[model samples]
Target chain A: MSVLDSRRGGGNGNNDDLASLEAGLDALETHLDTRASRWRKLLSATWPPVLAIVGLLGVWELIYRSGVKPTYALPSPADVGLVLRDQLSDGTLLEAMGTSLTRGGLGFLAALAIGTPLGLLIARVRPIRRGIGPLVSGLQSLPSIAWVPAAIIFFGIGDAAIYAVVLLGATPSIANGMVSGIDQIPPLYQRVGKVLGARGLSAARHVLLPAALPGYVGGLRQGWAFSWRSLMAAELIVHSPELGQGLGQLLDFGRSNNDMSLVFAGILGILVVGIAVELCVFAPLERRVLRRRGLLVARS
Target chain B: MTVLEEQRVTRSTGAVSLRGLTKRFGDGPNVLEDVSLDVAEGEFVCLLGASGCGKSTLLNLVAGLDRPSAGSVHVPGGRAALMFQEPALLPWLTATQNVELALRLRGVGKSERRVRSNELLELVRLSGAGGKRVHELSGGMRQRVAMARALAQDSHVLLMDEPFAALDAITRDVLHEELVRIRESQQLTVLFVTHNVREAVRLGDRVVLLSSRPGRVAKEYPVGIAHPRRIESPEVARLSVEITDDLRTEIRRHGAH
Candidate 1:
């Protein structure tokens, strides 16, 4: 086709100048840093979750006022609020939260220390990956509640029993995270790493780990859930005077005393803490990693 | 022996020597049958043929991405870096980091890597693209980044496997000029692989045609054309037609029982 008729983008300019202009335009327009505008973007992104929480509270208030059951069976939202207020005023709520947080935190840290390397080993070495891969999945599927009885027998109903349960619950998730992360890494990236002389330890450190990070982070989130659940289970099932009373103990105590409002408060506290940690910690950490690599998209 | 050690011994300037280079795949038919060719130091050589002619297989052997089944292949550099048809830059890294990665692997010091990566990027005329991610770049820009990445290896020999095959004609033309400029400036020994006879004629100082399946070198033509030879030029067209005729005969031979 003649130059005049061959117009892709119009205006019959000099070919060299036009080519350079087109190249510059292509470079500028398709560039990676198309981040949203600051304040408005953040506000828009946060509105949905904020609204959901408010709507949930409204529903709870509505259910409370309906008076569908006896107070012993289903306490009103106001009754639960009163218990929460009393616990907060007395400092018991803080103490229980601290106790549970310490146990879960310690267990998770230990799981991370043990499980990350174990998972890397399992992911990298073919024999170990095959041998223990299925077993790890099996462990993940087994509930932390089921471990409480065996753990008590093994460690005799003390801190050891609690820790044993936590270990059983959290380790699988951390290891599975590493395995899945490693598995999810594209073959091309590995090949590129190899081409770049990234062999053995260097490859794992620079390419494999970073490439597999998203999956590993996913694993950590799941592992935290397991750690939290297992610690609560242990606290409920294996009671000891030496061990400080935690959220789980408070929950059990509330149930025994037939204080349904206090029981609802404990349940709400656990859920609120879980959701809070996920939203405030893991979600931000994950978004930063994904955003740096230009993989993150605003959640609708 | 490693391709690097072989390169050093033959490093009388810029020359690639492959002797009795036979290759096979796991008890199967030989892919390359006792093939041998010598590419002069500072010469742009294109291995021209149709698919399964073992053109890429030869390039891989020379690149040290693979080893030949038998015989010796020597590039001037102990290590010869490669550019694939696809711009295989790491998606996670920006253009500069992709190039710097090669320098990093080569044990280039942390202080020197940035300087060297920038220099190489500038050499490819992508000076200001240090911070650009691979996915953000256009097709031609991506190839230039790939070129920069390959050059970062600082090897004497550069093996390219159809590096411009995926590009549009205009971009490919621009890159052809860029390649010639880079080769002239750097005094690089390029072992380029392509099925496009016109591209072969346009780019190479010499074109080596390979016969199909169990590929062997069928003919070698020294283009004798000056640099910046257009694809439409009479010499380029004449040589391209000659190479195409040879390539067709090889394909016809494959069909003749």
Candidate 2:
């Protein structure tokens, strides 16, 4: 009986024996996975999307070659790729990318600056939460495109109008993301934080903020998407010498000239930029947070 | 107020005092009522109760996380380390950082923090596990790491709310041994909460039972058994039966009403 009893009486000074017994306990207990490989993980993540794009391209080429719309009405993949090649060689593609990216970047940054505090306040302060919770939720569902005309009316045909459209479109999504994140934190964590003497600012910074990060990041991803789309809509509507030519303006110009290949190229630009931003910036950030916390499930 | 009590208090300063402690959330029925107990420095007391008996509520008050509706809770020290039924380790941090958070909050110097954290990890027999994330730990290991984290706070009084209840039977038994071993070495005053009859007898110097529905202390039993108690031993099993019968009667009263 004493042999099975791992706890020794005080003053026995049998720590070495206890440690060995605990070693035995550790050996019997199920151990968690020690590591997950990086490259295999990357491959598992990389293959499916690559295959999907290939499948899509194959279908698209078959339809185009079948003369479904008599070629001029809708261009072939080769025709779009040729236009892409010409634009890249002429530096027009890079110039347009710079213009659109600058607008989207500034717009998203503005939304982030305003929405983060608004979210923290709404999540923590009961009065503000009661005042704006429904409104924030309502705005989140409102399409960013609706803000285009209103932004034009307010700021007129300029970069200011484009920026305004992006901000209006994305702030609520960013703010609401923080709100839900804070709401979802397990109550036990808050209690533990309080017990550890973390009160007021210390509690919010150390406990509330980190705990709400995943949700906040989700908001940022949605907000970025909204900002980019709204900027495009605004660019399509407004034209100014100072605003410079962007991807949206290029698409609009293509429509006016009735150049189907140019239009397809514009569409491709928007689609590629959106996917690239998600893949390069937000997706990796979200994954890092999830992976560190063990919230991310490993894919085969 | 007695001379003997005052002398004892002076001899060992860290003690938890609850006098007429009561709690009711909002306009709901009382969660705990008129609970009074005193846990002396280095004493091990187990709080045993039926479901909804507000043993957790009592702990929250004792740890200063909640205000009692009536009466008071006084601690000799300003802080007491409290652990939940869940390990409640922050998923974002590795086990070492989880322990380090307590030390950081306590204002331990940055350079010394690592040494102290590793020492505490070793104390709980989680030496190499310090680098592991909370999710990378098994149930028992997480609880052990949590114990290490709780110890990091350097509080003399450790309040545990059924810290091992979620583990497997064998694992729980192993953790019980770990708890006893750690408590003995650290000379910690522990108020462990458990619903397990055998565990209450197996670990505590004294067991206090709470009746449900506006939980109040209904009974108390002292276990003078020697340390290294096996959960399945005959003496422990016998004491558990007696405590379980009393606990059942206390629970039965709520149903009778």
Candidate 3:
């Protein structure tokens, strides 16, 4: 056919060049700023959040300097900064941060371990879904603080109690996140999977799980928040010397001693760590998933 | 309610035979009733109907995605590969990986999978775009990749349910040409379903129109026009107009008591 076309001198030789050129043009138009001067995009995306944070700190400093409240009641930004500096220098704050982060990390890991399989079972098993679907949703609305007393009763007021509270708080959100994620997947994906002979476990692995990722990511973020909050709440309520000083313990100690700056420092510590985890761990994961799927619109 | 039984047939067998195929969903009226058709090896058959017609249900029955209430759907060359209107590529997978996923399910091995996946991508004219994610592809490209994924199943029969119905006219024309070229080169038996008259006449060797409300074969036109047929050509237009008239009458009858 190629020889005949070439002999006739009319068919595909010129059309091939034209087709390639058309493909090139299509590629150019559909290109979505990948691997081409990406750093510029990164910098542009980063600046606004940085500036807003700096502005927030500036306003806090100005209000303190205006002498709006008693110095004891409202510590100056400098005083909090000094407290931060002192804690770093003495290594006590570092130790507390280490302790609290360890607890939060362990608790979140435990929740992930337990919650993922539970969520899968809840999502896939019809009888269990019918029985416990509402129960899981109900558990999500119950504040993690409410679990503190029950945890204290079940596990006698130590690290075990804290761990128990964190698990109770985080597991439901993770499980429910996955449930909703599986629910939201378009039926088209599963049909495609089946036609391609992906059934049962293969269908769940290839189609359902990956399709449900965006919602699962949302659940993970919520799960982390609940775990962190529950851990802190448990720490504040049960202050045994054997458990070491977490930020929550420091805040509790500050309340007892009337050290407002210390309390302020602890609150700041909590906020910073939460933001760091979100930025460092989960935000990048969510962004990658969304960007790969073109669900995330690139920031201008 | 016959299970899809494996029949020992010689290789190079190229026909799908449906004998008294009927389907009904739970106590509702029959979705497809007593539909019988035979498409030869390397034949292009288009199943045309209105929206509510059970054209899709018939395709699903042949593809083994749906069970018929009665009768038989025998694709002599084995299970027909199916393509939907949507690309339905897994977003986590790149275009090549989407095709590769199909191959992998067929138990193709690692090194061979990569080589075969690249070959399939090239067949769809998406050789360079294999690295791109599904979302990054244009609508036309995604559908082409879907065609590639469907083809990757390596089945003798291909069942497509309005695969190109979603594309704009220009892109649709280009893909129509691509599909015909591939069908000829591969000698595949195709059972394509569409509501579009021009599309049916343009691609099919035999255009089979199904009536709505328990879809059954209403009419059949054997297209004698030579290949490398253009969708905009006069031959396609003349046939499309005649078929469209019949289709309109069929649809209007559905509204009557």
With candidate 3 superimposed using the best TM-score fit, by how many Å does residue B134's alpha carbon deviate from the native?
0.9
Query: lDDT by residue for model 2 over A180-222, one digit each (tens)?
Result: 9899999988887887778888888789999999999999999
Tens-digit lDDT track for model 3 on B1-257?
00100111223254899999999999999888899898877778999999778988988999999889999989877879998888788898999999999998989999989988888777777889999998788888898899889988999799999998888787787778777767755667899999999999998888999998889899999887766577889999999999999999998898887
Q: Which candidate tops lDDT?
A: 2
Candidate 3 error regions (>4 Å): A1-25, A32-68, B1-14
Listed in order, each prediction's TM-score against the native is 0.89, 0.92, 0.92
Q: Candidate 3 chain A — worst ten consecutive residues by lDDT sum?
A: A1-10
Q: Where does model 1 exceed 4 Å of error? A: A1-29, A298-300, B1-14
Off by over 4 Å in 2: A1-17, A24-48, B1-14, B26-29
Model 2, C-alpha of A278: deviation from truth (Å): 0.9
The second chain of candidate 1 has a TM-score of 0.93
Scored by DockQ, the top model is 2
Q: Count the backbone clashes (under 3 Å) in each candidate.
A: 3, 0, 1
**Least well predicted 10-residue stretch by lDDT in candidate 1 chain A:** A1-10
The per-residue C-alpha lDDT of model 1 at residue B219 equals: 90
